[model samples]
Target: MLKTTVLNTAHRALGARMVDFGGWEMPLHYGSQIEEHHAVRRDCGMFDVSHMCAVEALGPDVKTFLLRLIANDIGKLKTPGKALYSTLLNEAGGVVDDLIVYYLSDTHYRLVINAGSTDKDLAWMAERLCEWRLDVCLIPLRTGPTAVAMIAVQGPHAKARVWEVLPEVRPATEKPGPFFAVEVGPLCIATTGYTGEEGFELTVPAAQAEDIWNALLAAGVKPCGLGARDTLRLEAGMNLYGQDMDESVSPLDAGLAWTVDLASERDFVGKAALLEKGRQRQFLGLKLLTQGVLRAHQKVVTAQGEGDITSGSFSPTLGCSIAFARLPLGVAIGDRVKVEIRGKRLDAEVTRPLFVRHGKALI
Candidate 1:
């Protein structure tokens, strides 16, 4: 059975093209995907992200348990509602899943994980607790009386629109420092986003989603879809799991070395494996010099050796194709490479990731 969000009818009413995304029926676009992408870059746009799973961890040992499970240190979150982005790793240092952990209190923490990986992630966390005999409680926060729906409002004017719609949340949402969140009534407003824009990811009760969405629409916030979300995140140089990485890929090979806190004295999962194979192949950004769309699993040929594109797409903001590739260590910035697209070799340049931000092209 395909799962539907609370706003399914609303999306259809807006003429959004719906598609099956990872077992969930989701909106692909409300008319033109490119137009929606531009709206988020130049103005404000909203996305229905209710399919994402939110889990809460409780117990006095929550912090201690997290320190051992994630690659990033949770102790760094000194203030309440502070958020940390980290990757869960297996014993071999391979990425289990990348997630956002929010510190709510001394004995409480909230986690938001990818929708597709929710079942596996919950099961994995539970099994780890039993195997390690860790004294903690894990709870899955399903959308119901206690849990709620989440919507991501992104773009340059995203905050402004949010303030206009829900004026009562203005004070709390005003000074949400980067990677921080605040709870207002039933809404958890966070100044964080996947797209490289100033925005907020709001979590509200399922029943309240329609009201908020209607208010935002009246406030001139355009309804965006997953198509725009994908393009926007790609332009921002963010990795998409199951495409850019999976359980077989390590953070070190996915251009996420900075997220791994290896220098600290804190112990974490997959630390030993990271230390052992940290200097292998390197992950980098690729700008296609030829007129061709880059796609995942394409072969990349460099002077040093051959590799593959982890994530690739035609950037709507850049008006060109860009990609992330895991290539041999010898390949450096400014180096040229060839990508095999549709049985033809296309020229591309090796460069740093993040091709666009705040409606401007960076590469």
Candidate 2:
């Protein structure tokens, strides 16, 4: 049986077209996927992201454990509610999972991991903790009495819409800059989001989720689904866990080199392997010049060599088919390439991976 979130009934009541997503029954869209996409881009929209797991690390050795666990330098997160984006890597420098780590204090931290990789991520962290013999406790926050549900409200007007529904949290959430989080009573509001827009990812106790979802809906926040989420993230040039990369792909090869820290003398799980393997491929964006919708795994033949599309779709904001491809390093922006689709080589142009941000087209 597939798992369902606390707001499953609410989603069904909204007439969401449900689909199985990584073993979780999730909404693909309510009525029109395109309209939901435009709603988030032009106005405000909300998504149920309760499937994602939240884990809390507590104990005296928390900082030590995190410093050697993920690839990014967690030392930069000095203030409470500061967040850092990073990847968990294996011994071979492959991406185990990407996550957001929020610092509450030296002895307390929170990690938000992808839903599909939750089990594997927890197991990996457990094994690492045992190996290091650290005095730390990993608490999975998706179940039991303290469970929480995540709601992501996004768009240019997202903040205002959220304020209308959660006026009490406005004082605590208003001052934080992007990537910062603030706690107000039962709410944990983060100025962070998956969509390339101004928004807050609200984490509320599971018991209060339905009320919050209804309040947001009553406040005129359009309910979006996984379909719009995918398109929005793709257009923002963000990498998906299983699609854009996996345990076999390195951060350097998946357009996520920025998330990996290799400068400092500090050693992490995959530092040595990352230094040894280096960057082999270039992760970039493609604009289909010919008449065809780009899809993943299509053969991309460039002057430098052949590559594969990692993520692709017709961008509603751009009104064209765009994709993220792992191409040869020599390929440059403005370079023309050919993608093999249905035995036909379709023309495409290489460009920076980002296609849209803040309701504006970058390409």
Using TM-score as the measure, the top candidate is 2
> Which parts of model 2 are misplaced by more than 4 Å?
none
Residue-by-residue lDDT tens digits, candidate 2, 1-363? 999999999999999999999999999999999999999999999999999999999999999999999899999998999999999999999999999999999999999999999999999999999999999999988998989999999999999998998899898888889999999998999998988999999999999999999999998999999999999999998999999999999999999899888999999999999999999999999999978999999999998989999999999999999999999989999999999999999999999999999999999
Global CA lDDT computed for model 1: 0.90
> What are the clashing pairs of model 1?
none
RMSD of each: 1.0, 0.6
Give the 10-residue window scoring lowest on summed lDDT in candidate 1.
Answer: 138-147
TM-scores of the models, in the order given: 0.98, 0.99
Task: Summarize candidate 1's per-residue lDDT along 272-322 as a digit string, tens digits.
Answer: 999988757888899999898988999999888899998888888888899
Model 1, position 270: C-alpha lDDT score:
92
